[model samples]
Target: MTEQSAPGTDRLSSVATAARILREFGKHSTQLGVSQLARRVGVNKSTTHRIIWTLVDEGLLERVEETGLFRLTTTMRSLGASAETAQRLHEAATTPLDELRRYTAGTLHVAILDGTDVLYVERREGPGAIPVFRSVGSRNAAHATSTGKVLLAFLPAERQARLVEGMRLSPKTSRTITSRPEFLAELQRVRRQGYAENRGESEPGMCSVAAPIRDPLGQVVASVSVAEQVESVDAGLRHLVAPIVETAARISSGLGWNR
Candidate 1:
């Protein structure tokens, strides 16, 4: 019992020390030596070495091979940006999504991609609209939704390849793109068109149109979609993709996206 508990305690202590090191980096400049980090975290150099190397191996911190100092990598910035972007997206999208709800008289959603899944972060339903089968904090396959396509379509090519290299594109409906080559083609078209559409692909009687939400850096960080029962969408409204796209642009601009 003592041996088992001792290891757990040590692991917890190491974790706490690692967190302190990261915090110290944030408090000061980005670059710091291991010795500086150890002193800042109030730990001895050996323990600091263990913690720093662990974080380095995990890509949370990167070691400058020449300077032998550490700095936060793009991976770290990307993670932080993703969280901040999500918070800002939620705040900026609420009013716009509400307005979209009034315009479409349907369900609306804001989503982000988490690995191969679309994670719904916000949702609204119009009065008298059919209840969507999704909600905040729910996740579904990225291949099955317009929101997911908008998110996936803007991913860097290498990242996209990494995600779908060996993925099994399962069919959610007969209209779902189940072949990798076909899905890739679809994503290309979505990227060119600046939006994505799902016509009974995710749900048999449901249709959705989505546009990408970009951040200040012009990175696609989220998506907004208007969904409705296929029969309920007016034919004229189906051609009015501008409203949804414009609403997404409004939210993106609120998040500091220029142009």
Candidate 2:
């Protein structure tokens, strides 16, 4: 028999559902009426009004005067500022990252973990590089990318478990390790090795190696990676790139990562 759901699951589900409605509004920002939002979210008019009002009072959504329509507010400015800060930090690491690229002649990327995804903060292409598959502001599954795995490996056990629990481990390629047990084992290996590598896990014919960037407090705040064609990322080449990637990570960490 199937196990019963936990207490508070329904409440959490409702909040998540409501939050998804607000996110849709944030994406569109077309000034939706309460009725429209209610229809869109498949909720009753009273519930939609209550959610909208709560969000408005919290400064997350704004109501248009005279029109009775609402849109996302400047409170999202905080999220933008955070992204800006992360970009600035990536800029600060450019020197080291550039040095790493020069040394390895491979594409370099800086990324930070966001929820269960890795957001690329910056990227520098190397000589004769293959067309980059990722770019600044692009996101990918955290479990499939080298940078993502490094960051995830550093997260607290409970937090890591929570991130993977009940989530679909969708395979991006034949080589992608989508099994939870195998993925956890890989995380353990990353924790022991202090780095991680993805051999065409996300993109076919591409390989990437990454090292975690720690904050001053020793927390893993970001990651630095070098991506190259699979044929170019052999064991010998990995040895050459590891130290450079680690150096770039250290430089970024010095900028204010707390352990």
Candidate 3:
């Protein structure tokens, strides 16, 4: 029993150490070396080398032949694929997004919260639409845009405060809301109304309106927004587009989102 337990404990320790090493490597992938990784992870050189060698063997880490530096492997692609399959937010939002684009004749975007940022997962550009600055795979600050505001409004207050703490509310345009108190008030209003809007806050003359897409359980899982040039967005345009944006949220909700 003792002999068996000894190997098991050792294996667990190695795994713990390996996980730490991998985390450090991920944070500094461009310039990570075995010595630096060992120091950062609080493990000794020999153990770090053994752990790295094991990860490299498993194709989770790669060694650059030229500089002998270590980085993540192509196997990370498989992890990303698995995440995409699991999330399915983009797939769920597709049809509604098409309808939104048809209704608004502007750019429609679907995004999910990633840490303190919103990651664009899908987009549909309308015919004759002006080119948008954001693209799929781009990330934007959560406190500064419409989609981000809707999503953040749904999060618990503590979580929202924690996420925004130390984050710069950088001004992207003269119209952008950068003060934390004002931004928090806006988020509260979004929570009450079930949607949010931005008037050229991210980019000059680019206005956007967004609604939260919730799961069946009422949890905000993503957001859908329509962006257009400010010159084109009048009071009449808001009346036409808001309902379409809400409709898109409903469609995404039907795809298994709750709230």
Candidate 4:
């Protein structure tokens, strides 16, 4: 009788087999042969062939010069480099983030644009931190937060346009910008002002101000923001711009951004 598996077991096993095959590459060799990999991973030659081609299509692996040998691609190297850079970015932001939170008496955030969402990577809470943003590893809509706006504002024009074109523009509050044309105009204003604002866009009575953090190449890699729940949010967030911009600059400098 054929062995039975639960629903989706075949897909899960394929994924796990693919992962095992990938791990096998660096352990004993840089380039692997299909038959050799199949023997090592204990998968059938046919299944291993299918998974290897899938990885090749995804640019994770490439065949070696008309040979059966397969090796990891530059895409794998880039993915590894990105992981290291993300760690360095958090380390570079720490002292500046703490100082900014203390100086401004507001909760500080460091975020990156993740797809159409803003992924919060670091946070320092002051006494005035808003109740809604108490966690560091949370994600929020990109169109409804200051950090998201600042990161989006600094993106290259064509890429930014494409991203905006694909956005759903879902609203979190009445103050959120939900129109593509108006959102594009807002990004233009942010580019001119060199900062962005959130006036109760993500949460009721919450306000924030944000500026871009650059890498060594002067490309915007992240954003820093000061957020709080204020009674008079519109005017209250203005003063934070100076300190937020300065702190962002300090973090950028720490990351070796000279321009």
List of clashing residue pairs for candidate 1 = none
Tens digits of lDDT, candidate 3, 1-259: 4445654555678888988887675563554888998889898999999999999999988888999988878666456653663368766776666665446777777788878788887778765453544578888888778889998899988998887675688997777788988988998998997778887778767777888777767677788887777564233236544665566556666667544
Candidate 3 pairs with clashing backbones:
215-257, 215-258, 216-257, 216-258, 217-258, 218-258, 218-259
lDDT of 3 at 21: 80
In candidate 4, what residue range of length 10 has the lowest lDDT sum? 77-86
Alpha carbon deviation, residue 114, candidate 4 (Å): 0.9
Whose lDDT is higher: candidate 1's or candidate 3's?
Answer: 1
Q: For residues 127-223, could you state the per-residue lDDT of candidate 1 as single tens digits?
A: 5454444578888788888888888899999999888775668898787789898899999999999998888787767788899998899999899
Residue-level error in angstroms, candidate 1, position 200: 1.1
TM-score of 2: 0.66
Candidate numbers sorted by TM-score from highest down? 1, 4, 2, 3
RMSD of each: 4.7, 13.4, 13.6, 5.5
Indicate whether candidate 3 or candidate 4 has the larger TM-score.
4
Using TM-score, give the best candidate's number: 1
Cα miss at 97, model 3 (Å)?
Answer: 1.5
Put down candidate 4 lDDT per residue, 155-214, tens digits, no spaces.
999999999999989888888899899999999999999999999989988899999999
Local accuracy of candidate 2 as per-residue lDDT tens digits, 1-259: 7687777764765576568777776564558888888887888899888888888888888888988888778667557656766966666787777667546777777788878888888778776564544568888888888888998899999999998775567998888888999999999998898888988887777788888786667677788888777564334236644675566556655576533
Ranking by lDDT: 4, 1, 2, 3
